[model samples]
Target: MLGVVQTADGLPIHHEVFAGNVAETTTLIPTLTKILKRYPIERVVVVADRGLLSLDNLESLQKMTVGNRPLEFILAVPARRYGEFDTLLEEHHAQHCVGATHEVVGELVWQGQRLIVAHDPEAAATQSESRDKRIEALEQDAERWAGKLVEQETGRSYRGRKLSDAGVTARFYKAVTDAHLGHILKVALNSKDFEYDLDEKALKRARMIDGKLLLVTNMPDYSPEEIVSRYKSLADIERGFRVLKSEIEIDPMFHRLPNRIRAYAMICFLALVLYRVLRMRLKAKNSPYSPNRMLEVVRRIQHHQVTLHRKQSAKGLTTLTPEQKDLFDTVNLPKPSKIAL
Candidate 1:
């Protein structure tokens, strides 16, 4: 599923489901086209993560137009491209504060975009600590695996029971592949015997780019701080997805038909829209309660029925706390009242 969330309000504008086998990059254009058509806005600035920031997608976005005005974009560049801005990174680091995110802005005329690169010292410290822990764990596991290989080679009781070279290689690869430590780990295999060691140079290079984020945007008129702020808002889209998958229960769908699946997604999208609206209302009013808390309080307000002489009927509402009343007022909703009918 591909979801295009509006950055202004952090609500889903459109969503589309592709075949499970299709790559997320492949769905970007199609999903975006649907959004442009549905919204019919004169201008838009797309904010997306690195996963959707392919060269082809960037070029296509450069050419796209809405009512003859070119579309703008704020896309995240992957950390793998960190070397491309080494000079800028150094310049920024020179002026970087001890615990602040200092922005180093630059332009690439050939690429037709401005770069807003940020370095956060606190974030770097956190990332470095986490990486060190993971590396330590990886090293310990690699040593254990190497020891097992040695046992298999030296144990006479298991002469024919030793693992094959392929098995040992597979185990080594599996250990390092998804751990993001493959580049730093050197694995050697000889028949059933295996050995692994950390490459310090590679580890140092990886750590150099920690806590650095590169934001590229065609909207150069915006200040670096503005660009960084807009890019950070992309987290709202991620949060919306989490809400759909968790609070809205958009997954584990039992529908079999494509139309039914699409409908289910639409329902979830509507629920998210409503959720955002309520959230905005609360935020605007500076309400202290969260949406969930307010909902819980409202849910406790029940209605009761009373009958007199088997003909007269009256409807009465449960007592509303001051907090509940404040919530209703914040949302511009009327409080439930008793009625005689």
Candidate 2:
């Protein structure tokens, strides 16, 4: 799934699901092209995770530059890709940010454009702590399972219960304890599978790798703070995915035919658009109403029954509260009928 996030404001403007084989370099440019064609947008800055980062991908964006107007991108990088990146950790003095220590690394030309690297210290620290906890938890879990494994494998009566030695359970348990300790150790150490690290060295390296993530961007004008903030804000679209799948019932598509699936998705997207519109309108009125709340209100209004008693002329009337009237007006709908049904 691809998310085209708005940077000036936190809103997901476009989204699409694509085939797995299509590279980001191939998909990203066309996606931006289509968005620009349809929407009156300018100089879009695409942000993506580390999976989208590649020298080729960066050059693709660079080649799109026309007459000094280049596409802006903020993408995460793997620190191991550069030895210079490791040097930054020690020499760079971090500028205090929102709970993160940020150091604005000078612009370096990459793929024909000067790219900025923002290094954050506190994130590395927090990441290190989190990795340590996770590794410790994994070790504890493995040890706990190893004991049960040994008992089952040996078929020894523990506390007087007959344990079957030649059963599926026995085999499974034996595999757990007898499996390569190196694999388990590697996981606990947070090092690559084949890389060797002594216990203390492993712990230290784990802290360094865990606590750090990288964001690389060609947009020189954007400050380090804005890059971090906007890149993280992509989580907003992730939240939208949950709302689309669960709240809006977009997934588990009840259709079998490909065309039918497309139709179903379109309908769900339309519903999402309407819900967004209602939410935006309510927010304009300073209403602390969410999309679901606004939907409930509109549903009641939609189901409102009006009784028309034809007096001298046939006219229409609707039972509408003042609040409903204001809401309807805000949404640019026709005023509730004055003529009673």
Candidate 3:
């Protein structure tokens, strides 16, 4: 397994390989240890999604320190999972409501821990719309599945898995769970077909916290807005990973030796560093082409060479297009020459 760590500015800082048996969540400790040992930054804040932090991990992190100072962290919390927060959330919404699409709705002390809650109306709307669409499609699927019962009554059958009551229940539940609406969707299995119901109360509860983001943090000096901003920097980290997987093709390794695998990973990491540097350079110059796109354009330019029987060989680069020349100028890179060295 491979792990990568990056900064808020979309720059990769560290990477490591792990045994296949190592759970992804367990890699955090070693990765952070290596990072802290190598960089020795005085103030370090680990910001991550809810999936990364267990209760034990949080406790361990709270105890971890650097240079005699405690390490800080901003972690997302599943607010809805904590029913105790419902009353507090209602109060928070009532007292700190704002008209903006997104805002820090409230900052409350829960279990003596600082919890900053934010709301995003746009995100909420998108989520609500998605759920509604999925539910609608699910209803349509139910109707079709029920129609099979009618066919069964008339002695008609299809050439796939035979439709059974148990199969219908299992299949429909799988779909519900896949859509994450298991709480809101209800199903009844019968000998004929299947019946399902939408739990209005459960759905209302789900919709209430659609875009509500709750963050738990140990950084006392930072404000709610600042905490939210740090958590949002996760986007840049994700972008770094995306660039590695898509552009560098870091996976599907064909190597047999461990050292060669590490070498490949190191090369990929270096390539990522160079890629980001080129990206920054292009952005600084306001170039229209991305580094990947720029490479595509430049690769089109070719060098031609011809030699006479007894004379020195002649070599020249193909003519550079206006776009290619402008790109080179924008990036301050010297264009290749046809002159033989």
Give me the candidate number with maximum lDDT: 3
lDDT tens digits, residue span 39-150, model 3: 9588889988878766888888888887888989888987667777777777666565435555545688876779998888788788989999999998888788878866
In order, what lDDT does every prediction score? 0.74, 0.58, 0.82
Candidate 3 Cα errors over 4 Å, as ranges = 79-85, 93-105, 140-168, 189-195, 308-312
Q: Which TM-score value belongs to model 2? A: 0.65
Q: Give model 3 RMSD, 1 decimal.
A: 3.5
lDDT score for candidate 3 against the true structure: 0.82
User: Which regions of candidate 2 are displaced past 4 Å?
Assistant: 1-25, 36-41, 66-68, 78-87, 90-130, 138-184, 187-199, 209-213, 256-258, 302-323, 329-332
Superposition error at 316 for model 2 (Å): 9.3
Q: How accurate is candidate 2 locally (lDDT)?
A: 0.58
Candidate 1: tens digits of C-alpha lDDT, residues 288-332: 877778888899888888888978888778788888888889999
lDDT of 1 at 211: 76
Q: RMSDs, each prediction? A: 4.0, 6.8, 3.5
Better of 1 and 3 by TM-score: 3
